[model samples]
Target: MVLAIAGIFIVFCSVILIAVSDRHPDATEGISSVPISIISPFQDAVTGSITFITGIWRHYFYLVSTAKENDELKKMLSQAVEKKNQCIEIELSNQRLRKFLDFQKTRMAQTVSAEVIGKDPSPWSKTVIIDKGRSDGIRKGCPVVVPDGITGQVVSVSTYYSKVLLIIDRNSAVDALVQRSRARGIIRGMSAEDCTFHYVLRKNDIRVGDEVISSGIDGVYPKGLRIGYVSGVIRRNSGIFQEVDVTPHVDFEKLEEVIVFITPAEYEFEMP
Candidate 1:
């Protein structure tokens, strides 16, 4: 009975060991496979989760870097555009200055270069303030001019600035003669854009489009300086003088720079 019981016990133990051990068709060693089999699904799930999180982090970092690069590129483009505009403005200014230099060579008298800094707000008067004054040799009655034609004469002066009475001012007048027929007339300001030729006789042979130039008798402007052009002419039998309308060559509203002629000492105080 004891021998039979021992054999039975040994058979039961062998069966249990075979159930837990690895099944091999040719290998001799037996490795436990139950633990690994149970844990494989969990391991795969953990690895997949880590891969997904790492991918999302990398994508977010790439997006942030791209946005920063785009901002920097936009700023660079804006700066380039601003610099281009500045270059264009500088070129335009240089062109204007060149014309002034060319005009300066034609003048026989000394001149002071000045910039128009302000204008009179009074509607009854047309005048501009220049940056040069007595300290710069500018004086009252000094003839102011531009490249186009005669501008005005200085009527007031300070140490560093001067006021120029434009030809369009109601109080302004110049002794002018028609360039075509040598007809003499007094160019008087009538409005902001028009001047009237007074003392022009009806038989003076004046006509529209005739240029009026200074006769130098006014003692303010130089001889042959352009004052304006005759725009209209009317004949009347009752009056000795004809109604003549003149238009000045200078564009008063667009005045930016001027040249003040440094006249002789005797002509400084002779205001026109």
Candidate 2:
């Protein structure tokens, strides 16, 4: 009895649908319109969500690529700046070497160039070590000088290096004369940066700003070589000698290269 009732209901619904279609004659189109309208909003929503996600992915990848490129550019710029600084240092070194060369050509003595490699370890000694040594014909008592003025004399030598005793050492002294007054005095090292003019009489016409040069009477330093300028002059009515301070022309702290006047040689050569 149940099966017979279900079959009757299904048949009855089908008959009613057929009757409605027959009356409208375009019922299939009209019936589909309502469902299409309802499903169209859902389809459009899915498509918009997909497009938004795709745009975000593309923008994210673009930003990543741009960041990588910016990093590369920054690295390149840093390397360029370092190279420029190196070039400037090289140019300045070349200028200094050229000036040294000119001084060597004008000097009458035989000279060999040497680079300063080290300084005296003892605080009491004002000395520097040069790269040239016995193998290069450098010997003890060789006078060391630079373009500006006299530096010192070589005191010790090895096969590959030599030690120079700077004029600013306490034990060092030079016979000097005032260029303007022709007054004779001894230039003695009192400190690392200063020297004293000794044995000058109080009646001498020595004044500040006078240029002192080597007298060449000692037969060590050549004649007319600059020693220093008078920085201070103290006259005393009681003492036989006046107190005078001389500031050296060469700044020892900034010394890099020097010329060594080697004995028995009369040629100029650059330091390696």
Candidate 3:
């Protein structure tokens, strides 16, 4: 009875081992559902980790590329703006040259063209610098002029530049004639943008709005070149001569270029 019982127990253990080893995957999953559930969660976690890693790499690459492009675009924009400003400056310079050329055509005197390069250093001196020099025939006391009227005189000359004493300078003087009465007088500079016509003799003849032109008597400037106009006549002083306040024909503050007039005697004789 003991031997038979041992043999049945051995057979039962064999059957249990075969049943566990040969079980279907579905049958195993049904038996212990936790492992299947763990597999799904592990697969999801692995897939999510891969997706997060890929997304981080893609965004980082995109940002790096975008920043590089933005820097390049900014450089291009700055260059374009600089080019635009340069074009505008060139256009304006061309326009000013055109007007300066027109002024050259009207005068019979030999001309030396010069650009205004500087303004008065001293507050009391109304002077400007011209680009012309001694080599260009610009000299001290030579009259300077523009299309509208006389500007000033060459006060000092150097190798590359000349100083012009403007019409409004305190030391400036011009022989001017009254356009209406044909009267002659000396106009003296008093302040910036102001002068006085001396030797008007009578105050009534020199009224407001009277024009003044070079008389040619002084031999410094040619006749009929405009100097300025009488803005007001001060007769209140009741002196022998009237004090006529004059505004200069040219605005010295905005002066750009001028022509140094070569006398007719010098130009006509020098022609070969």
Estimate the TM-score of every prediction: 0.58, 0.57, 0.57
lDDT per residue for candidate 1 within 178-198, as digits (tens), equals 999999888888656989999
For model 1, the run of ten residues with the poorest summed lDDT? 24-33
After superposing candidate 2, which stretches have Cα over 4 Å from the reference? 1-107, 264-272
Tens-place lDDT per residue, model 2, 191-272, is 5699999999888999899999988776678878898899999998798899999999999998878999896334354443
Cα lDDT tens digits for candidate 3, 1-272: 99999999999988886687456323442333343234434444554576678879888868969888989999999999999999999978865775655532233678888777566658887887676767787766789999879898876666556668888888778999989988778888876678988887864487788889999888789888998888998776566777788887887777876888855322222211
Q: Which lDDT values do the candidates have, in the order given?
A: 0.77, 0.80, 0.75
Judged by lDDT relative to the true structure, which candidate is superior, 2 or 3?
2
Which residue pairs collide, candidate 1?
none
Candidates ranked by lDDT: 2, 1, 3
What order do you get sorting by TM-score, best first?
1, 2, 3
After best superposition, candidate 1 residue 252: deviation in angstroms? 0.5
Which candidate do you rate higher for lDDT, 1 or 2? 2
